[model samples]
Target chain A: MKLLEDRIRQDGTIKPGNVLKVDQFLNHQCDVALFDQMGAEWATIFACKPIDKILTIEASGIGIACCVARHFGDVPVVFAKKSQSINLDGDQYVSKIYSYTKQREFPVIVSKRFLTAGEHVLLIDDFLANGKAMNGLIEICKEAGVVIEGIGIAIEKGFQEGGRELRAAGYDVQSLAIVKSMDPDQGTIEFA
Target chain B: MKLLEDRIRQDGTIKPGNVLKVDQFLNHQCDVALFDQMGAEWATIFACKPIDKILTIEASGIGIACCVARHFGDVPVVFAKKSQSINLDGDQYVSKIYSYTKQREFPVIVSKRFLTAGEHVLLIDDFLANGKAMNGLIEICKEAGVVIEGIGIAIEKGFQEGGRELRAAGYDVQSLAIVKSMDPDQGTIEFA
Candidate 1:
């Protein structure tokens, strides 16, 4: 976690509106080595959990989830699609969530064939701000009857309620880098 | 590539309209071990090329590209965004492509900061059918002045013109599994 926190401090940019742009090494342009290190940290943190599969949302979480899957005994990574596609068919567990980035609501869908009942799963994502997207995945997991082992987040905005709410709900949430507060003018970031 | 070919033959489903659904291991629900093997194979195939980074699209390609980057000496993986978001800003190289799954034309946008001039990149994707999406990436590469070392595709529909067109354009395309044809009624898939 210290490695990730350090990398974020070194390469992340603090923008207005509490935005921490770590795209240079996090989401858009990925640093696989850092992701692997993050996976190592998560594996040690969630070492006791029975993770049968790694569930995440599309576009952003896919890469991180895939890299982390290796740390959990090569479990299959099931990425919930943001939109309905021709390839996705059959019975599905769907949960809708609002995206402030896209400024719209999108459905997070996973096939019933992938996430089954009684499967222990870990939820992974790049960021958890408002927890809307995290809640959607939790809803799908609840509907699918899969046991939520824990949640693994690469970056969490500590000032936001997403991480706090998940922890309050008794879910084991392990965030690599939690931004306590960020100053755009001073370009400083504090971690929790 | 035989490992991938065999996996496809075993787990891949033959669907109507020439759809070979390998989402069980290839895309939707990913098998990381298999992806690791794919990365190994691509490493051997494109061994001589100087690959500075890996470029792919969002949703599907991100996972595979991240996995494949490890085989390329842990190179950075840059995934082009299929949609605009608050996270994305500044100068970008944009190209439009039609998605048969979504049934709409979408823009493939990559930040100029990621894809710089004189960098050698390898274009990667989950599926290459008509090559429209690949073409869009190619156009962006041309505009960005990046050298495309080669193209790595998980599966290619040989009956489609994408592979042929890319090959005709003098691209060293290395597809793990190329489907010669598929029978929905018979539930059979042949490789090229």
Candidate 2:
């Protein structure tokens, strides 16, 4: 986590609206080695839980989730689709996610065939801002009757309530780098 | 590539409208071990080229590109964004792509900072169908003045014009599994 925090400080950008742009190393342009390190950290923290699968929402979360699944002994990673595709058919576990970044509501869905009852699901994501996406994933898992093992995130906006809310709800949440605050003018970033 | 071909034959579903669904292992639910094999295979083919970065379209390609970047000495994997977000600002390399699957035109954008001029890029994707997505990615790389070393695909629909068009255009394309045809009723699949 220290390494991630350090990397964020070195490469992350602070924009208005409390956005920490780690896209240089984390999201858009990915550092696979750092992701591996982050994945190992997640594996270590959730080592006790029975993680049958790793679930994530598409685009941003897929890279980190893919990397993390390797440390979990190559566990299958199921990414909830943000956009409905012609490929995805039949019964699905669906939930509505409000994207604070995009400012819209989109349905994230996972095939009922992929997730089944009693399966232990580990929800993973790139950032937990308001926790809408995380909650959507959790909702899908709940609908599928899959046991929610824990939540793992590469980065968490600590100023946001999503992480706090999940923790308060008794869900184990682990964020690799938590941004406490950001100063755009000073180009400074504080991490938790 | 045999491992990939075998997995596809075993787990891939033949759907209507000439769709080969490897969603169980390739698209939706990902297999990290198989992806590692894929990365090794891609490395064997493209390692001789000067690949400074791996460029891929987002959603599906991010996972493979991230894993493949490891074999390329952890250079970096830059995935083009399909959707616009508040964080994506400043200079960008953008291209228009027509999605046959979704039946729409979507703009794929990559931050200009990521793909520098003269950067050798290897485009990685889960599938090469009509090659519209690959073409869009190639266009972005071109706009950025990055040299496209080659293209790597997990599955190539041989029946589609994408592979043929790229080959005719003198692009180096390596697909692990090339599907010749699919029969839905018999659940039969042919690979070239």
Top candidate when judged by lDDT against the true structure: 1
Off by over 4 Å in 2: none
lDDT of 2 by residue, A1-192 (tens): 999988988999888778888899888999999999988998899989889999988888999989889989889999899878788888988889888788789999899999989999899888988998988888888788899988988888999899999999999998888888889999998888
Q: Write the per-residue lDDT of candidate 2 for residues B89-121, one digit (tens) a residue.
A: 999888999887777889999999998999888
After TM-score superposition, the amount by which residue A109's alpha carbon in candidate 2 deviates from its true location, in angstroms, is 0.7
Report iRMS values in order. 0.7, 0.8
lDDT of 1 by residue, B167-188 (tens): 9999999999999999889888
In terms of DockQ, the best-performing candidate is 1
Off by over 4 Å in 1: none
Tens digits of lDDT, candidate 1, A1-192:
889999988999988888789899999999999899889899999999999999999988999999999898999999999998888898999999999878899999999999989999999999999999999999999999999999999999999999999999999999998899999999988999
Please estimate how well model 2 matches the true structure, expressed as its whole-model Cα lDDT. 0.90
User: What is the Cα-based lDDT of residue A4 in candidate 1?
Assistant: 90
